[model samples]
Target: MSLGLAGVCLALVTAAGATSGSVVFVPVLSFTLAWTHSIEKVRWEEDYVVRPGKTPGAAPVLEAVAARVRGSGAGMEPPPDARLRHGWYEYTPTLRHPAELRLTRSGFTADYDWCTGGRCRSMAGLLPSNGGVTVLTACRSAPP
Candidate 1:
């Protein structure tokens, strides 16, 4: 079974360099990644778009990452183009195509939240507690 919704698909690669069989997400075309800075303790959110690959059965592409930071402090500097809106600095940072967003689950700070289709779920709830790195990438289908 797949966990993805109706757009793209994703899987979790643990810190041990092994892909977890039960970890998956049937994501939508757009998703928001939210996490807290390890040191700053400030919240940050990034919106991403998953575009289908040109070739059949090929991995999809991830692009258009618009990010926002709650407050700027240590390691939380917003870009010059960032605009303050509702107490958050919103800006669209440049990102290379096929972006691979790697998030570290240190089991110390708050767990990252992946939001889509007006719903939010913690990464910890979607995957096992490995306390390692979880790579979120675009895929055409859920891994077997």
Candidate 2:
């Protein structure tokens, strides 16, 4: 039984019968469509679930994220103000900048000032799903 990702989806679609089959097909198809996007260099899987107000990024998967960050964007370029605190990483792009990207074990936050005028404002939003990306390659066949 070659039950790979697509195979598993097909089996589910078949089991759903004709009436609600379209519903199942749509979501499975979306997963297939994910191939179009860039695969991040590193991967984070089986992320830990921390309680509200607790810090994130303490999972072992975070080691991969940290390693990927080191060699990335290397050069004479200035390094961002990066802090690993309470299991979350906060990166301020520059000094006195009204912007920061914070990645916790649970998710990420982007806060910044839109403008300096009297109407200037700041904004942030919580993530719907905190799961970080996991890069999947084509699974290889078992040795014959």
> Runs in model 1 with CA error above 4 Å?
1-23, 55-58, 142-144
Which residue window of length 10 is worst by lDDT in model 2?
28-37
TM-score of 1: 0.79
Query: Which lDDT tens digits does candidate 1 get at residues 1-144?
Result: 443333544456655787776646555688888988888889998888888676755567888678899999965689899999999999987774645777778878888887887788886766655677777777644434
Whole-structure CA lDDT of model 1: 0.74
Each model's lDDT: 0.74, 0.21
The best candidate by TM-score is: 1
Candidate 2 RMSD to the correct structure: 18.8
Q: Which pairs clash in the backbone of model 2? A: 56-105, 57-105
Per-residue CA lDDT of model 2 for 54-85, tens digit only, reads 23322111111121021223232224555545
Candidate 2 lDDT:
0.21
Task: Estimate TM-scores for all models.
Answer: 0.79, 0.15
